[model samples]
Target: MQRANEALQTQVTELTHGKTDHQGSDRHTTTTVVNFQPFSQEIAEEEIPEHVKTLALDSYSGSSDPKEHLVYFNTRMVIAGVNDAVKCKLLPSTFRKSAMTWFTTLPPGSNADFTEFSTRFLSHFSTSRSVQATITAFLTVIQRENESIKSYMTRFNELSVYLEDSVPSVCVAAFKNGLREGRLNGNLKRHQETSMVEIRARARSYILEEEDNRQKQKRDGTTSLKGATHLGPASKFNQAKTNRPGPYQARLSTRPSAPKPLKVVNAAEASKETGTAGMNATCGGTMLNAPVSDILKEATCL
Candidate 1:
């Protein structure tokens, strides 16, 4: 029984190591190969298309959005008519630098399918997901002071395209509120229930009216200036003549007149003999002292 047990142990030892040669000088050794691929054995062994290898795809690094890269990759694969296994094989071609390094670090055969691979890839680079803009972010979209209504609308619409859930009424309100206060703003506000189509029509009409008014003002100014410039010498002469003073008031003295000289009148005084005769006539001595002729002359003088 002891000898049989010894023979069985020797057989087990030879099997554990390797088969010995007939001369016991050489051994037949077996080597085990580990598959380091992240994909299952079936996917790794799958034959890749020659056209797929030649096809140029957009490369991705750690910096850009990982999900976007996957989307683009999947789209290209679908167009190429490749299966999920080919897709898994071709994904590494799109990776570069850090992305390639991350791919190399994945556990061997950890991803059994394309879905599992994509899930793992997204999980690792989850921080790279794009953050969507909220409704409140639209509050910062204001019209510039010098910007025209058309320019403001274009800018507003450009931003609104990114906001998928934006309300039409809120956007309209924002547009109206952002406008600089003027006739256009007042007109828009007066019709609060107006739709976007109506608003555009009104804006178009307002813009056209403004342009027309500006053109009219320019034409009037130009006409007046031309009329003034072309005034003939004869017209100037007529204007000068009209401005002159009339005949009655022409060449009037500007200074005060000198005073008039006073005049004196001379009269002859009564003679002394006449005065004596008059005195004698008044008294009783006048009859004796005066002759009849003298008395008559004196009486006449008196």
Candidate 2:
């Protein structure tokens, strides 16, 4: 009887232990299976915010990658007609975030930002026709943002000053004019002055050439001096013998008489004599009167 009681106790203890272990395993499996779907749903909802949804809805919405999304957001900020000053303040911070995000996602040592994205973005305004339209649209959007034209101009000038290196000619001109008329400070004007100095330096050669030509014509007695040296060397020798004067004496003797007034030659007579249209022919059909080099330089400076 004692042995049988001991066996029964042992059986009860083993069964109890087996039941406890089975219950523990079932609880662990239930926890994992039951909580996973709800947790995953929560995570998915948390990852996508309302702003991101709205951005995705927009025509120019950015990428799914956070870094790319940041760049896209900033680019859309400009396209969406955000104020320039605001954009200037926002862009650098967003750009840093974008770069960081991009770097983190990329493989170590990958070259993601090596491409000049800004250059590609600005290239859309490389021509006059497109530039004018873009500027007009941007200005219109700025005006609608409760900002004055002057304020808009100032901001635009500030935004584009660094970008001037890549901006088109018409766009730069438009920006310059806007700054000149506006709430913008004199920064563009100062740049203009520097550009003008460079232009004048470049055109110096042309100006000097024009001045030299004028001086030469003035000293050469205009058209009248061309045929004055008519005597051949032999005739000059005969005249020297007849006059009994040395070469220097002939020059001195000729200097005493009052100089005769030169005949004012007409255009036709001058062209006929020269077998060309005078200076006009040599100048490639352009009028020599207009200061073309100076005008071109001034236009470029502006």
Candidate 3:
């Protein structure tokens, strides 16, 4: 009887152990269920149109400007005529690396709509947003010394692209202020209310005139240099000839001439003789309108 009771107790214990094992397995299954997602039920359920399969988007890895990526995404979506629901679905496909990791970490059902999703994305990546340029930035761009007006214009125009709301008059003002002081600046100052179109036209004319003047000066300088170079050889030859000794120089060099003997004569007698000789020559018609002192001066000069 005791053995039967022991057997019955063992059977009861086995059945109890099996029930506990089954319950433990059921609990484990319940805990394994996952529910993490950033999108709402509506967005998740939204059907992606057939046209979306043909489209491809470049992925963002959180390294570049997030705002630019959004702008590009929005532009394409607008062109494709996709709705907000479709935008939400398509946007995630463009994310990779850190961007995808960021998306995955967002709380479930946090994004109710495309607008909210975009807003959150922008807010989270605010540091990665491209700084919107202002008119102040344009004003600060001064034309460097010796910088060409054409080059300055190109730089100014390139900067203007960032300032979408920049007025033509304001641009003209900024451009005028930034110019190196010269005829262009002076001309711009005279026209207080000039349009950018007129400013550009005036600049073009000035650029042409400046180029022409530069070319003329260059040509003049080249001609002057050539003239100097052409005359250089002749001048050098003349100088060398002047300094060079004659072929008979060695033969001509001989003993110095003896000093003349000193002669003493009366100044009055000499003057009297010179005056008489000059009067005779003047009267003979050989010397015309000649005075004694003039004749003396001419003899002295000779």
Please report the candidate that would top lDDT against the real structure: 3
Reference-based lDDT, each prediction:
0.65, 0.43, 0.70
Candidate 3 local Cα displacement, residue 2, angstroms:
71
Collision pairs in model 3: none
lDDT of 3 by residue, 109-144 (tens): 888899999988876665332223447577688988
TM-score of candidate 1 relative to the true fold: 0.33
What TM-score would each prediction reach against the true structure? 0.33, 0.19, 0.35
Q: What TM-score should be assigned to candidate 2?
A: 0.19
Give the clash count for each candidate.
0, 0, 0
Per-residue CA lDDT of model 1 for 1-302, tens digit only, reads 99999999999998866644533433222211233578799998999999888998999886676777889999999999999999898898888888888988897888778999998887665433222342454577676764556666667766454332334576677677677777788888788744455667788876666455545535443223211222223344555765778775664644457887533211111224234333433333234234677556656665
Ranking by TM-score: 3, 1, 2
Q: Comparing candidate 1 with candidate 3, which one achieves the higher TM-score?
A: 3
lDDT of 2: 0.43
Off by over 4 Å in 1: 1-35, 128-302
| Clashing residue pairs found in predicted model 2 | none
Preferred candidate (TM-score higher): 1 or 2: 1
Regions more than 4 Å wrong, model 3: 1-132, 164-166, 217-302
